[model samples]
Structures are given as structure tokens and as C-alpha cells.
Target: MARIASEALIERLAEWGVDTVFGLPGDGINGIMEGLRRHRDRVRFVLVHHEEAAAFMAAGYAKATGRIGVCLATSGPGGIHLLNGLYDAKLDHVPVLAITGMQETSVLGTGYQQEVHLDRLFADVAEYNMMITNPAQLPSLVDLAIRTAYARRGVAHLTLPNDLQVAAADADPYEHVAPARPPQTAPVYLQPPGIPRQEDIEWAADVLNKAERPAILVGQGALHARQEVLAVAETLGAPVVKTLPGKAVLPDDSPYTTGGIGLLGTRPSEELMEETDVLFMVGTNFPYSKFLPEPGKARVVQFEADPVRAGARIATDVPVVCDAKEGLAALLPLLTPRDDSAHLAKYQKMMAKWRSDMRSLENPDRDPIAPQYAISVVDDLATDDAILTCDSGTIATWAARHWTIRGAREFYLSGTLASMANGLPYAIAMQHAYPDRQVIAYVGDGGFAMLMAEFLTAVQHRLPIKVIVNNNNSLGQILWEQMVLGYPEHGVRFAAPEADFSAWARSCGGFGAKVSKAVDVAPAVREALQHDGPALVDVDVNPNEPPMPGKVSYDQAKSFAQAFLKGQPHRAAIASTLFKDRIQRLGD
Candidate 1:
């Protein structure tokens, strides 16, 4: 019988479907490292400078592939470093399993060297936590951890004591457990009792039968129900407007499809929402209440999977609680068709006009480089199948508004929690998971500097990722807000001398370029993309320039004007520029 030590553990991991594990080596996990060396052909180990980056890499792999991401680390500080990435995985609903080496079992409570209660330390981040003191318990615990990670769609932690890992055990005593398969649950039908009443259905049919203008609002929930949603949109002769997160629910080229709506939204959708009298919301819980127009003015109908989410934000005259696909299927059969040619034409005109208005800001003649134009250029240069990861801040807003994606591409952002410094970590993970796909990180100077150390992780793995830094010396969003609202800008600017990020990238053994002029952007990007390994494009943009075609309320405008009038001398010119183009009237 062979000993159920660290060597055998790596064998078990390979058997259980772990192809890659990310971690930094240490003394306590030397045995495990040897085992990894033995199985180099079957399982590859990704060594990162920080355990936190390892955890994040695992998360990115899991999110992209829907498989459990695994990471291993030594006890004490190494184990502790995994906390941040684990917490991020838990919050983002990614499956990850972390294995940590611990002190000998005999010295459990004797304050041994490099000793800490790892199970307790990881309790907050993991859905399941366990410590194995006996070699006999290793196989079962490993299987359970994998199962728990998949079941909960979150992180799981397992601690292995040094002594226990090398103990002899009965050979083949534990049977290899097959991976747990997902259950085949019954499909949810959209209809519920006492809802979509016969009278209501008849009235809705009447409205659809007589309506000349109707529009569809698609949300994230519609992604899984694309075919059904498209069918309903086609049947009703209605155009589609998507929420930001629902960008992929319908193809951008679909005839009925407009674009997204809100502050980061495009023109077509906003115009359709404004002109259409009847609006059907499909599978979206858009948070911005202000974007939902007056309920009395528009005849609103909503279909959703969750009952509580149906009318939480805005009043819905027609509400159906069911899956978006199921609801659309049922509603389409009951609705009557009507001529929407005139209505669609009117909104189409509005869309064209708004698009024209938006294009004015992207003119090459515009000075200081319009942020929107820069994003548009990046979008055009990116591959159709590229994966875009954006940091939270003004850069995220710009990327969300301008980045175009197809069905094969993915766009990831920290939308719910809105955390900064996620772009680099996210890019690292994406590169690790899909080496063939192009991965780009759109980040701001402040946000990129926050977690810049992880750039070493990319170099170590030779992961080819492109980092585009929007180096606007200040926090652009907050400054713009201060200029718009009644608040003086304080502590919103970075005073340090600009470090040559391109030089830093080269020093770190990666390709790098610096671009100050607008004409230099394309060539710099082309050069970065041609590099064989990690690359960076440090772009110095105008800090004084505001995001073009500024959209804000009248009250916000007045407050911003007041604040500017009473502002500091250094910012006087920028403040005056913002107020110079102000229009007093509120209506569009």
C-alpha cells in the first residue's frame, strides 16, 4: 500500500478534473510541489507572485469555463493572502477550491512556526471549510470540496496538516467518486395562478391590436430566452431596447434592435423609449428609476421570472410572473398584431438624429481628445471575439457605452459592487483560462496603480494580455460631478509626478509604449497587439477635458455653476469651460 501523502493528493486532483492549479510555493507545501513536478504532463501549476492573484486567476477560469478553479498555498501568510480573491469569487458567484498546507498535527495548539487557524481565517470567504488531520480522510474531503464548490457556486477551503499528508494508508481503500452531475429540474412555465387574467389578456390584446407604436425592452434575463424574445418582438412588429447588462440578449444587427438606455446609453434606445406609448419589459431589473419614464404616459407591461422583481421599481399595468422566455411564449400567442410602421418610423428618425448629435463629439477636430472617441477607436481595433474587462470608475462608463461585443465575445465589469482595481486581475484570469482569445483591460491611471503588482503574474505565466491605461491625472468622474453638482473638488486629484508606465513595463520584462498625441494611439495599439507576451499602452490624456455632450439635471447644473463660481484658482479655467455651453431650459 502506498502512503496517502502529497504525491497521492496531486494524483487525486488530476483524476477529479483539475488540469491547472495557481499558487506560490512555500516550505509547508514542498511535498505538494514535488507531487506537481511528477505530474507535469497531466497537470500544470501556475506560479503567481501573490496568492491573491492566484485566487483571482482561478475565479476568472471558473467564470469563463463554468469549471471549478483550484489554487494551493502554504500555511500562515500564504494562506491568508488568498482571502481577497476568495471573497471576490464568492461575491461574483464563481466556483473555486483552495487547498492550503498547515503545520504538523502534533503541534496543533502549541504556537508552532508558521501556524495559524486557517479554517477560521477562511470562514468568511468559503462556503465550506474543513481541516484534514488524518490521511484516511483526504480522498473524501477532496471529493466533498469539489462537490460543494459546484453546488454552491462559491469558494471552498481545505487545510492539510504536514504530518497527515505523508501518513501511510490502505491502498485503494477509498473509492474514486464520480463528479456530481447537475439535476434535471422541471422547466419553469411563465404563467401563474390569478395573473394574466382573461379580461386583462383581452384588454392587452386590444391595445396590441390597435397600437401603431410598440417597443420591447430586453434585460439580462432575456439572454437565456433569446429565441423567444426575438419571436415576440418579430410578432408584435416592435423594436428592441436593451439594458446595459442585457447587451448580448439580442444581436446588434437585428433589425428590431436598438441599443442600451441610461447615462452610458446610446441614442436609438433612449429615443424609442421616449416616443413609444406601449413598452414591454422582458427579463430586466434596471435599477435606475429615473430612466423608466412616467407610468401614466407610457403603457408599461413586464414579464419576469421572480415575482418580487416584477413591479418593484416602476408600476406595471400588465405584469406576468414567469420565466422571460415562457412569459413571452404565452403572451405572443394571446396578443393581436397591429401595424407599427408609423411608430417605428418616428422613433427611427429620432435615433438617426440622436446618433448624429453624438457623432459631433467624436470629430477629429475636437481638442484634448474626446474620451468617447478614444473608446470608439479602441473598439474598432479590438478583435470581434475579444474579452473586455473594465475597472470601476469613469473608464467603466466609457467602455460600457462604446465597447461593442458579438455573441462570441464577453464583457465583464464590477457592476453590482462597483469595486476598483479589478481590471488587471480580471485580465490575468481571462488570459489564463482562454489563451487563444484576445483579452483587453480598459483601466484608469488611479485604478491601474492600485493593483499594478499583479502585472508580474502576467509576465511569469507569459499570458498575453493588453492593458490600456486612460491616464487622466485626476479622478475624471468625480471631477466632472463636482463641476456639475454643488460641490467643490477636494482630494480628487493625484499630485505625484507622472511615472513613465511604458518604461516600467519594459523594466518588468513586458512590451510597453507611451502615447500622448491622438495620432499615436492606433500605432501603439497595433504594436502592443503584435507583442508575443503581456503588453501595456500608457496613454496620457487631457485631465481638464470633460466627457462630451454632458447629460445632467437643471438643479444639478445650477449647483455646479454655484460651486464653480466659489472654486479654487487652479481649476478656474476648467470650471469656466464646463459652464460656457450650458443651456438654461430643462426640456430636450
Candidate 2:
């Protein structure tokens, strides 16, 4: 039987090992929908409420499994909705394939109904972007898109016109050149495992050996090199500091590691960067230069897979371009083990104090539940191998500090792009990838509200993921940012009659609970986790509570004071909250 281009495309995707496709259907993609129907047994189509969520789910799936994720959407606005999530995948360097339907080929130049110039729109976000004009191009285009996404570790895009999608998948009769292989045949593409130069390894080792206090910084790029990173840290008696995306690279319990670094990071990690004389960065291009050591103060060594990013963030004395696992493995054997424990011990002590201080702030006795306490309860209740994802906001800070990554647990967030509304979708993807494992989303009220409709998708699929909402009824992070940036809080708070997130979950055919008091946090979280299917626990947290930075500069303090003097809304409540928190910390 002769097949249409859409069916051939699905078959080609199946051959490329794609088991699932996350997307929303539309009129422009009727042919694709039929193809999916025909191949339902071989491929699962995850219907999403929004195209944006589909993109995020695809990116999340790729991140969790280290495989290419595919998301599809119809033409025009649907394709436009996918940009933010695609950019998230691009910035984080995750491989994702995005398929969009376009208006018929006859309307290419003319602005037909729902006709979007998708090729130009996706140019900046995609590593490879193309439109399939002929049925014959579907097979090769799909192959190229997948290979390019894998090779670049970013988003790849393909747009198929409505008419061309249903056309017969036969070569054009007028074609002049003969092909080497049949049109249906796809050549397998495998990325070579990168190996670093011996001299580069020796150079990195020499730099590490020469310094009295060396530090190791890891990122998502070094995720697969856990043992190698730990081994090198131990050899140099160095403290390992992770970027937020690399939080699970080493279990937080590891003796050689300090936690994350940056405004949302642990204090011990801040100190590690400040005191180290030599900094060995493993597969990380951490953006904030201020959080890094002074340019000339510390000699830098970077190991990265992308050569262009080797010395892009910080000045590098030695740059080793190779895969993180391979580079760290080779350099480990060349390093001389140090007997000094002073550097590692110092940070370990600092980490202990930080942990203690954090615990003090997690006060369960507070009238309105402390957000930290709520997250702590979830942390205590989550399974050993749970996959956790958090949205961008104050929730990010809370999760980073309180949630401990241990056992086989993995953590994800919008690390580089720092996009909101990603938590629920990421959780859904994680749940789909590992059916039996627990998947949880730690999201703020604002972020969750943005993509809250996705809860229905979770219920529709019978995904047993749990969502914990920090219901502050305000954009807590933005309010704090306004204060610290010398601006009065404006347009951040939600109107009265705060959302009943738990009720929404229950309405969507899932378990729901609301926790108003601090004491009820643990029981509520435990109940949600124990539920048979999807669940959401909305905790009414203290809105005035601030996500205090690891190290507050004098300018920041002055600006915060300035904002208060400038008549910031709810100034008195914020001040009272701040004063009480300080007194509590002092008493602790």
C-alpha cells in the first residue's frame, strides 16, 4: 500500500527510536493526526492543553532521559506558542525536535489564513530549521532534524505544509540524479565519544597541583561524570560547587561538595569561590561573572564539550575541549593526590552551619506556613528515587536550599533560561518517562497559574505526579527583586479571593488539599504523596517572606531600604516579617 508523507514521517520517527510525541492537534495538522492514529500502537501521542507546555514537556523528557524529545503543533499561533519552551531547551542545551504544520504550499508567499513565516520565526532558536515542501523530503528532513538536534544539543525544527503532508511518498518523476539509497532508508547517526588531548589533561593537572586551594565547579554538562568529578575533588582536597542544573551531579551528602553557587546558592559555595586560588570548571559556562573568582586572582581551567564555550564565561588559563566524562577521566589519573584536608574541611564546616541556619528558618510553628517548611515536608516525604522539578521564582530558591538530592534522585529547573510555567509540564514528562517512579513539582502560585490547565492533561493521562504549590498570592520573587533593585513594589500582588489550587485539582479529577497552618504542612504533603493518582497541595505561605540571598551586598541593603522609604505597598507587613525572621535567626 502507498503511504502518505505523514505516515512515512511517523514510521521514520519510529525507526529513529521515538516512542512518544507531545503535542496539540489543530486543523492544519489533520493529516499528521491521522498518521498518529494509524501508528497508535507504535507511538504514543501525548495531547497537551497548550503547545507551550508540549514544548516544555519535550525538553523535560530530553533532560531526564538524555534523549531527543519531540513536540508537534499546528501552524501560525500554535507554532508561535512554542518559542519560549524551545528557547528554554536551546539555552539549556537539551536536544528537542519541534514539528509544526504550515499553510498549504500554494499560499507560501501570500499571507493566507493562519499563515506564519515559521522558518524565519524559528531561525534563532533552532540549530536546524526547514520546511518540507515535497513528500519526498519528509524522510530526509526528519533524519536531518533529528541528527542536528542530537549533534548540537539544541532544538531542531521542521514545518510540513498541509497539502504536502498527505501527498504520496514517492520520488518526483522529473528528478535528474539517482540516489545511493532508497528514499525510505535512513542512515544511522551516532555522535563520536569525544576524547581530550593528553597535553590538555596534563595542563589542567599541573594547574590543579600548583594551587594551595583549588575548587571544582560542575554543571549539567558534567552530569554523567559524577564519579570523575568526585575523584578529582578528593584528589585535590577541593570543594565541589554545582550550578543549579548540576545539583544532582553529586549527592549533597558528599563530603567534598559545597552546594550551589549564585544568588540562589548556599553560603558555603559562595565562600568556596572567594577563597580558592585555582578554579577547575568542569563542563560549566556559569553566566554570572560576579559569582566567579576575580579574573587575575585565580588561575582557571575549564573542561567543556563545546570548544566555543571553553573560556567564554571566565578567562581560562587552560581549556580542555572534550566530553565531561572523558576529559575528567583522563585528567584524574594525571593528578597528584593531596594530603591537605584544610580547604575541604573549611567548606564542610561552613555547609554545616548553613544547614543549621536553614533549619532554623524552616519554623513549623510560624502562624502562616513558612514556604521553607512546606518544601522541607515534601523533601522528607518524597521517595528515594523521586524526580523533582521546580518553576522559576522564590520556589527555585526554596527548592535549591531545602531539597536534598540523594539516592537516585534527579532535579531539574529552568536553569539557564529561567522560564516560568515549566514545573508542571516537566513533572508530567518525568512521570511519563518513569511510570512507576514518583515525580513531583515544587511550583510557586504565579508559575503554576500560568500553565495550571496542564493539570487536566496529567489527569487525562492518569499520571500519578504530585504538585506542591507555595500559595503566596503574589509574585514573591518579583516583589523581592523590586525591593533589592531600588523600586517600589508595583503590579506584583494578586487580587483578593486567592485561588483555590487544590479545588482546581479536585475539579480536574485528582486529589486535592489545602494547608493554611504550618502544623498541617507535613500531613497535607504526606496525604498528597500517598494518593493513588495525581495530587496538588496548596499551602498558604507567608507572602512577606523573602528569599534572602547567600551574600547580601551593602548596595542591595541600601536599595531595599530605599524602596521601603519610597512607599512600597505593604511596607509595614514586609518590615515586620523581616524583623521577626532576623530575631528568630538570632535566637537560633
TM-scores of the models, in the given order? 0.78, 0.98
For model 1, the local distance difference test gives 0.73
Cα distance off (Å), candidate 1, residue 413: 1.8
Tell me how far candidate 1 lies from the true structure as C-alpha RMSD in angstroms.
6.1
Q: Model 2, 19: alpha-carbon shift in Å?
A: 0.5
Q: Write the per-residue lDDT of candidate 2 for residues 26-66, one digit (tens) a residue.
A: 98888898888889999899999999999999999999998
Quote the positional error of residue 19 for candidate 1 in Å: 2.4
Q: Quantify all predictions' global Cα lDDT against the true fold.
A: 0.73, 0.90
Residue-wise C-alpha lDDT for candidate 1, range 1-588, written one tens digit per residue: 354467657766777778899898998787678778877898889887778777777877776677789988999999998887787677666689999989987898999898998999888888889997655565666767777887666899988887666666333334474423323342121224423445555555556555466888887667667888778777778888887557777765566677777766665676666667788888777777677666676787777656667777677777766667756666677776544466656655655555455444443433455565667677778888888888777786677657766666677765444567778877987787788999998888887887787777788778999998888877878786766666777778888787567887888899989887787787888888878999999887667655532245577668767776777444666754444323211112
Clashes of 2: 0
Cα RMSD (angstroms) for every candidate in the order listed: 6.1, 1.4
Error of 1 at 236 (Å): 3.9
